[model samples]
Structures are given as structure tokens and as C-alpha cells.
Target: MKGVLRFGKVVKLSPRYIGPFEIVERIGKVAYILALPATYIVHNVFHVSSLRKFISKDPSKIITEDVNLQSDLTYVEELDRILEFSVKQLKSRDIPFVKVL
Candidate 1:
């Protein structure tokens, strides 16, 4: 996929699918052009693997959430916890490595 990586900071906390973005058109076989907001400077074309279809079980329903999208279209993420720690072997000695959630 030629598309760039987004939500680097909030990769863990952010929801995987943020939209039912309108599909402008289909590009080739597995690619699509979406009508994303102007804040998203990245290319609109995305591969099929990166896209998810939105389905509504009820005809009349509204979903709401407290999502904050920054000027760059990136959302905020919260830290979960520190899972574990390990020792890293160096040339001179070993050092402590911390893993966070």
C-alpha cells in the first residue's frame, strides 16, 4: 500500500475504523478514492485491505462518541499500562528495557 501511516501516537487507543467516508471512485481493482476531509493532506487513494465497509443494522440510529480530531486529523491516545520488562544485552553489560501500554 502506498498510503502513509497515520495515528502513530494513538495506535493503541484509537479505534481502527473512524469513518464511513464516501467513496469517490474505485481505482484499478483493489484501490479506492475516498472523499476525506481537507485536513487530511495525505493522498485519498487507499488499498482495499486498508478500507472497511460500514453497515447499519437499524435504519434509523445515531452513534456518538467524544473523539477529538486535531488539525492534522490525528486523535489523542491514552497510555494503558506497563506490561513487562526485560534485559537487553549490550557489548559491555546488560541494560533494563521497559515496555509500556
Candidate 2:
């Protein structure tokens, strides 16, 4: 995963899976080394429980954008579009909120 090792953050907003990297070699029964990109500073070896199989419906649908990371291992997230917008009314105020993609 992208920020799997990052601590003191909200779990729900964290990265689920970063890549579908190729397996380089198997270390033991449950450990395997992956061929990750050079930009990633994490350890190549990982436990089998942390990995997930990638299922692709269409190859052309996959987005291959290059994410530029900062020195702190964070990237700027840009807003694509607003999916929804709504206003909540209270006794004395109205709160506006947006659901974005």
C-alpha cells in the first residue's frame, strides 16, 4: 500500500492498495519480495496477508498517472469534480457540504 507504514492518521482515509507490482522472489512460506518502483522507499519484502490480487475488467480503463511525492511521502490531491452538493438546515444556520470525486 502507499501509506501503509504511516502512523497517527485516520485509517478510513488512508491508501488501501498502491500497486500490483510483480513478485520478484519468495522468501519463505508467507513472505515474498516484490519488484516495486524506484520512487517507493519501503521494504521490498512483504507478508502475504498484506497483499491483494488485482482483478482487471478492461486494460484500457486503467489510469497510469504519475504521482509526484513530496519529501514527507505525501502527494497533493487534486479535486476532479464535485459529485454532489447539499445544504443542511439547523435552527439558526444552514451548513453547506459537498461530495467530491
Candidate 3:
């Protein structure tokens, strides 16, 4: 079955399982961009960076943060900005060719 992948439709994916975990689908431009928050939970808490490698054969395609330093905070702060940016882009809903990268 087909599904709606947008900020508004995120609710639908919140309570369901996708792959090894439950996730809400989010369509960015061309392909379905996995929800970052959900992805973070699985990535950080569960320790599965394999998804990054799976998404992009070239390491450059995979987005990352610089937490290698001596900072002890939490999740990558950049993800917050990314989600905010993603929401804005989706809301305008005008440019279909805009790339988040």
C-alpha cells in the first residue's frame, strides 16, 4: 500500500513498525527520507550506524556531525536544525527539486 510522506502525515508513521523498528515515512524530494528523530533513536540509542553506510555507498553522501571532540552533550544538535529546515521546505511545498543536502 502507498502512503503519505510529509510533515503532516508524520503522525501516521509514529505508531507503526517499519523495518526493524516503527517509523514514520518522510518524503524529501526524490526518495523517502527517513524521519531523523526516529533514525536518531535507532542510531544513537541502539548503536546501528550501518544504516548510514547502507544509504550511501560514498561516505560523502551520508550526513554526519562532529561530536568526536570532548563535548558531552547528547544527540547531534544539527539534526534539530535539519528537521526544522525539512519542515520549512515541506510546508512551502513549492519547489519539488530542492535537495536537502
Candidate 4:
């Protein structure tokens, strides 16, 4: 229940049992990771509930605003569309393999 996940150091939270998520990229001290495109962490996101603020006054906040959901959807859709279009183009051109535009 307690261990360290490191970009370079250790962060100790009771890491919600909700990830075999993959880290796609990392820059600086932060990581960009992805999970199976669903909302899993249904609660306990805000460590700022009234009781928490009462118990510990460190009321810092970061809001992500569904950026991941939007980005993943866009990425998947764009990739699919690109592949389909490439297939059509290749079929029309009768090209055996992709050549420079």
C-alpha cells in the first residue's frame, strides 16, 4: 500500500488501485500517461474535501478539465481517419507501397 513512483524522486500516495496505465511521454518532473479510455477514479480526486482541509490545511489544486479524454479521442479518431484515407489513396493510385506524396 506504500511505495515510491519516481520520475526522479519518490511520491507517496495510497495510489488508487486503478492503473496499469502506460506512460506515453515524460518531460521534466511530470509524466503523460494513458489508461483504457474510461473514468475509473470515480471519487477521491479532490484531496480538498472539507474534512481534508480541516485535517490538513494544504489546499493546493490542479484542474485537468477532461483534457485527456478529449485528446485521446482526437488522437484515435485522427489516426483511424488517416489510415482509411491512405488506403483509399493507395488503392486509387495502385501504389504497392507509400511513396513520397
Q: In candidate 1, what are the lDDT values of residues 1-101, reduced to their tens digit?
A: 23545533445564557667779999899999988776655578888997887788984564634456676667666669979989999999999988888
* Per-model TM against the reference: 0.52, 0.70, 0.17, 0.20
Which residue pairs overlap in candidate 4's backbone? none
lDDT for model 1, please: 0.72
Off by over 4 Å in 4: 1-15, 40-101
lDDT (Cα atoms) of all candidates against the true structure:
0.72, 0.74, 0.33, 0.30
By descending TM-score, how would the candidates be arranged?
A: 2, 1, 4, 3
The clash count of every prediction, one per candidate, is 0, 0, 0, 0
By descending lDDT, how would the candidates be arranged? 2, 1, 3, 4
Give the residue spans of candidate 2 off by over 4 A: 1-10, 57-64, 92-94
How many residue pairs in model 2 have overlapping backbones? 0
Better of 1 and 4 by TM-score: 1
Tell me each candidate's RMSD, in Å, in order: 6.3, 3.9, 14.5, 15.9
